[model samples]
Target: MTSAYWPLADLRIRSGPLELRPPVPAEYEVLADAAAREPHAHPRIPFLEHTADTPLRRGRRTLQWLWSDQGTWRPDQWSLTLAVFDQGQLVGVQNVRAAEFARTREVRTGVWVFQDRRGQGIGAHSRRALLHLIFDGLGARRAQYRAAASNQASLALARSLGYAEDLAPLTADDTVRHFSLTADCWRTRTDPVSTHVTGLAPALFMFGIGHE
Candidate 1:
């Protein structure tokens, strides 16, 4: 996709101490290096055999998948994957995706932080920024998220952000927990909010929203 085709170009969000934006091509290596150094950054997601040692390759692959034209770009089937920055350095990745989305208007979010950055409240702030992007900027009706059953940190983050528990089926691994959130519920929370969102109107239109 051309730079102009990137829907989230120039979009940004801040929550307390974090900023979230689309990853520049030049920053991919930085993001990859951070991930390579911290496999525990995302405790719930399992690492593939080549993932820990080959983060640059993994980062490239993720970019390719996100930008692929063959993949559905409808509001429901698309994901806006962003790099999380702390004081201008790449530290993590966050994603908001829809499944069976056209009919549901519901999105799911996931996030990861560098190993060294844990306990600094970066994850929580980054996630809140993404929520604003989806619920306010993108006009999404609701959002959902899941964490591994054993990922206490993720569960805590979800609860802290007002995501209610949902009964999900047992995964093959039996370690996943599901959570859901509504826009109204999120708006009621009193978290600090900061963001710079540009091109959101165009991006939302590209995703099928007629009026922002």
Candidate 2:
């Protein structure tokens, strides 16, 4: 049904016990419920500020954010937000996005897992899947990441996945750190984790790939 109109709905990425896919209409409320249950409120981590106002607000914000991405998708600029599921249970979400990716060949990513699921290497596996999609499935040249300087977990994840810190100056706030991983580096990085992307061939056109 969804794949008949939006092929992206058919895309999936699997790494270990994790599965990443675009949330279907039925799962929209489920995603909002997850956000309400687990409000990510780290001051440094960039989350919707209004989410902490109330549980109802949190859920509303989550739905709005997801819908915005879905409605605004385009080949030149788009965000692919994948719901993370472990054994068919929704755990969290991982997002990979790019601007003019066909020419720039770069992408950025972010992830959020339920509090209970943290420290179980879910974040690492989710990222590996996105990297595979970026570099292998989409033929990206480099991948980028950004996190608040105080967000140790995010920075650690990037470093552990073989990303090098970017030397560029931070914004006026000087609160975020940037990192990058070239495709060559991703290919040679010795990480025990491996990922597989499926249904990508049918969705490549959605990402503006295979046109050239």
Candidate 3:
């Protein structure tokens, strides 16, 4: 499909009450609000290098991230950041991305929920939806996760999903941790998040799924 059509916009993955889709105006606004209001006291920010100090800053950063990733997708490497919505309201962001996916058949995941929405199982359901997309929709063989120790929530979620601790220099900080799951390892979690992926048949070639 052409960029004019933005075929990715048709893509949607749903699990239980959660849905993951490319960011639109409404979802982007929620992310900015969450970033600004969600406080992180640690010196090491939870995200790569994002700040939620102000609404304008958060808005710019989120917009930049969404547009840049959308513009740069390729079969060999890509970043697909989906907006996570709960009951039609934006709650967080979930990502499934990788490089040389055709040969490696791997993808990595990262998730973030609004500060006020935490502990309500949004993170878990969102990531499970991503895994469903990666492995089921995109045919990925492996999925990965890395989080700093200070990000206890992320680490805990990884463990709960049967991700195995892995040896990797995640960052300059030693507190950072890494984890991975093979397709086999992935089957263990067995969460009841029944997945539904649509708008994928036409996009299979781009993701190297099936005939690609």
Score every model by TM-score.
0.80, 0.91, 0.87
lDDT of each residue in 1-212, candidate 3, tens digit only: 23435667788888888888888765666676666665553222333255325556655666677777878888778888888889888888887888989899988877878777899999888888888778777778899888778778878989888888876554566777878988877766676857999977767667655553
Ranking by lDDT: 2, 3, 1
**Model 3 TM-score (2 dp):** 0.87
lDDT of every model, 2 decimals: 0.70, 0.81, 0.76
* Tens digit of per-residue lDDT, candidate 2, span 76-141: 999888999988889888888899988899998888887788898888878888888888899999
lDDT of 1 by residue, 1-212 (tens): 23565555766676656677777767766655554555433444333125244655555554454455225566546767788888877778788877665467788788877778878888888888888888888777888788877778888999999999876544555667888899899888876666656556656655556543
Per-residue error for 35 in candidate 2, Å, reads 1.6
Give the winner by TM-score: 2
Between candidates 2 and 3, the lDDT winner = 2
lDDT of 1: 0.70
Model 3: residues with Cα > 4 Å off, grouped in runs: 1-4, 41-55, 168-172, 210-212
How should the candidates be ordered by TM-score, best one leading? 2, 3, 1
Count clashes in each candidate, considering only residues at least 3 apart in sequence or on different chains: 3, 0, 0
Q: lDDT score, residue 27, model 2?
A: 90
